[model samples]
Target: MRILASLQVRLPPSRLFAPTCPTRLKSFKPLFTSPNSDLPLDGDDDPDMTDPVKLAFARAEAYKRQKLQAQSQKLEASLSGNGGSNAALENPSSSANQGSRASQVSAPKGKPPEAEIIVGDPTKFENIRRRGEEPEKDDGETEAYRPKVKTWGVFPRPMNISKTYGGGKVIRPGDILETKEDKEAKEQRSRELVTAYKSKMGLDVDPKLIAECQKSLKDGNELMDRGRLNQALPFFEKVMKDMVFESELHGRAALQWSICLDSLQRSSEAKVMYKKLQNHPNPDVNTKARHFTFSFEAMEFMKVKSSYLSRTTGYEMYFDSFVDNKEAYTSAKTETKEAGETQILPYVVFLVSPLFVILLIAVRKSFML
Candidate 1:
């Protein structure tokens, strides 16, 4: 029973756990002998007993060591100026259990993870948006409500306005104009154009004849331009009669004479001229006739008498009556004034003559008595 008591036994301790093994201690090394041979058995020794007070002291020491380690770490972080424990320091009353809240609260202290504000390229963004997106809202205006643009049409209303041309001169129909400086200058130019035409015809033309033809042609051209082809006909005929040979001038004169004759309502004369021109050697006669065919036709149409001739005759008679009435009124006014004077004369003569007779009779009576 004594040997049994010498066996190694492990005891539970109220103290802190120790890293040293009690059974492996050097002082307990000789206890490995058998207990029946008067030696302690390896299992017969009792392990060290742990006291509650020692366990409490060890726990206190451990807490102190942990606190020093934490302080050192905090001191290192603070030396680096890294805002160590700033969240807890700034808001000490905040709950430590809420880690997400702590991180959020601590975010402002540290350099916020390089918030690179990336502003996209304006041109690139504009191109992308313009390609696909609808345009920005307009300020409440529809395209149809916009003012219409006015445009001039092909056949706009004819303007009755008279505008000045060739300086400030006012132009009118049938105004005889001489653009030349003097009568000499006019005659000189006329002689030149006539002489040039005569030379082209290979005819020995007289200067006086050329001058007369030139004058006729000039007057005819002016009258024709004013649409007085009836008045222009005699002048053009005289020019054609003076031309000895059928030339370009002869062709022009024939064509113009035909036109003037048509305007004068001399259709028989005009058709004769046209027949002669149709067989003329010069091509200009045919060309001029072709181009002016419509003009010649229009002149013929103008010759047709309108049905309003009787109405116009009545208006003329009414105008004559109005003139006669004015003359009759003047005669009646003279007669009325003469009659008034005659009536006044008779009254005056009767008043004076009776007085004169009474005075004469009275005088005679007085003498006789």
Candidate 2:
């Protein structure tokens, strides 16, 4: 009250926002009054100077009363006379105002406009820096121009994957990636198969025959080492010419015979013996047969034989491996030579020129001495 008295003219929200037509509102009565409104605001003379809260309550009550009156009037018109058209005719301005308010309340908001895109000619580059500029009309090149296809990179979907050997092993198609367990199982199965085959053969060598074969093999090897191939021939033939194919002695004798035949320039016979030794029971004999040292004539025969065989066949890959390594080494050397050219700086020529002059002077001094 003291602050209001000091100001001499008190300011409140109700007076600033008072309705324009007070005379019409003054005659109206509100149905719902605020129970908390004990602010002496219902006074006839000081309506503009009322508390802001009281004024808000009064306005809300007035609005509710007006809505109720309008709805009741609409209902009365429908019951007594024509209908909605008559009600619209009776309150055209109010109906228009209500429509405008409804439209304002339910109005859709706007968004920024989308970017405009213009396609260009199919034959031309669309992203050229300068507009209307084009490439040359044609060149003498006969090759057709092909552009890389535009494609989206689709991420591979997650899969519930499993492997034969389990995780941490990188496998590719046709790779023989055997794990320890698989290898062991394979070895066991192979042993079983070999035992079964041997049992099926059912034939046994006599003790005397085995002893004689061993003695003959030793004598043949000793004769061969002494360069007496003709003398070794009879002993090796004695072991190889019999039904001792399953014995290690027979394989050894066959290998020695092939060697002797190759040394004697009997290449055709040597190749047959070597090929026969490939299926020997002894692993060492089979390996030696496949990878034996041969004379020039034998090697020539092998070349002819390999030409008839497929590149993936036995010993063909071994032949190609040496050629492949040579080619690779040659290519690497060529690349290194091309890349390692000595680069001499122009300034280093000055140092070299002085050294050459000193060298010439030293030579002249030596000649003078």
Candidate 3:
């Protein structure tokens, strides 16, 4: 009651002379509001009056603004020692009010944005190379599918590839970087097919070898005809390796192997096998091997045997195709390095110039001494 009396009695004399009417009390405005607030003064003048939700929002906002203004005045009064001493107070709410005043962003002007239709190919923005949706047979997959690969912790582990993604194969380069071992394994497997196969030349002295070779050859031939070069090549190779080199059957196996190799784009390996056929005991095999290896005579020979031989399309055969690019590339690289080494002017300028200058200095000093 004393505080209320003090507040009322503290009113200025100018405001005491003013008439205290019921209408004035009903339409009373705050002495001050937050500078940033755009709160509606009159309910009827509010633009959001049409929308009940927006009208409620505006009224709530106005109420909040009035409440904040009252609080700010209380805070000022406390600071000015009119209220209890709160000089050490954090005044977090006062700071927040200041922040709110500072954070007032200007309302955006003009019309609201409309959706625009994109022109031209939508595929230009797409990188979707997957042909079909990935088969999601996760139930069939093992619970823990750790790859059979050795990886250092310091180096990225192959298993770190996130399994969180939808089904699609992730190509990790760390899994495929073994150039030497992979090549050795591939070569070993290819050679193993040749040694392990039997009966390919047909009617071997050993019955078991004969059966194996014949089966291998048949399987290989069938696979080759069906466009399975990789599967077929092994059978032909096994048969060729099992049979005696001098035998006509062996030469036939070589011919088939070479033909298959040509189809498989392994013409270099095929040429090596074709070259060995030059030492074949059978005269027909010898001539055909030479014809296959010798590009000059192959066209004319191909013309004569075009009816049957024309079946293998894009079949390439060259005597020099027997020689791989490795040897030639190494030689050329060596020659270039040697040529570069012989031209030492740049090296002399960079390395020997200081030495030469030092030598001349020493000579001049020696003569002066």
Question: Whose lDDT is greatest here?
Answer: 2
lDDT of 2 at 129: 32
Instruction: Show model 1 residue runs off by greater than 4 Å.
Output: 1-202, 291-369
- Tell me which of candidates 2 and 3 scores higher on TM-score: 2
lDDT per residue (tens digit) for residues 68-123 in model 3: 66656655565456742462254556645655542332234588876556478978
Determine which window of 10 residues in candidate 3 has minimal summed lDDT.
19-28
Query: Considering lDDT, where higher is better, how would the candidates rank from best to worst?
Result: 2, 3, 1
Would you list the C-alpha lDDT of every candidate in the order shown?
Answer: 0.61, 0.65, 0.64
lDDT of 1: 0.61
lDDT of 3 at 106: 25
Residues 1-369, model 1: lDDT tens digits:
999899989887743244222222232211123453322223334445234464456445544555444444444454457775683485343334445643554456756664434377766664343443574543544332222234444332323222222344666998756554776797999999988876767366777887778888888889999998878878887878877546555677778888777666676677666766765667878766665554556657889432123436556877787787464445888999999998899889988998999999999999999
Between prediction 1 and prediction 2, which has the larger TM-score? Answer: 2
In model 1, which residue pairs have backbone atoms overlapping below 3 Å? 6-44, 7-43, 7-44, 7-45, 8-43, 8-44, 8-45
Q: Candidate 3 at residue 137, lDDT?
A: 38
Cα lDDT of candidate 3 equals 0.64
- Against the true structure, candidate 3 reaches a TM-score of 0.25
**RMSD of candidates 1 onward, in order:** 33.0, 32.3, 29.7
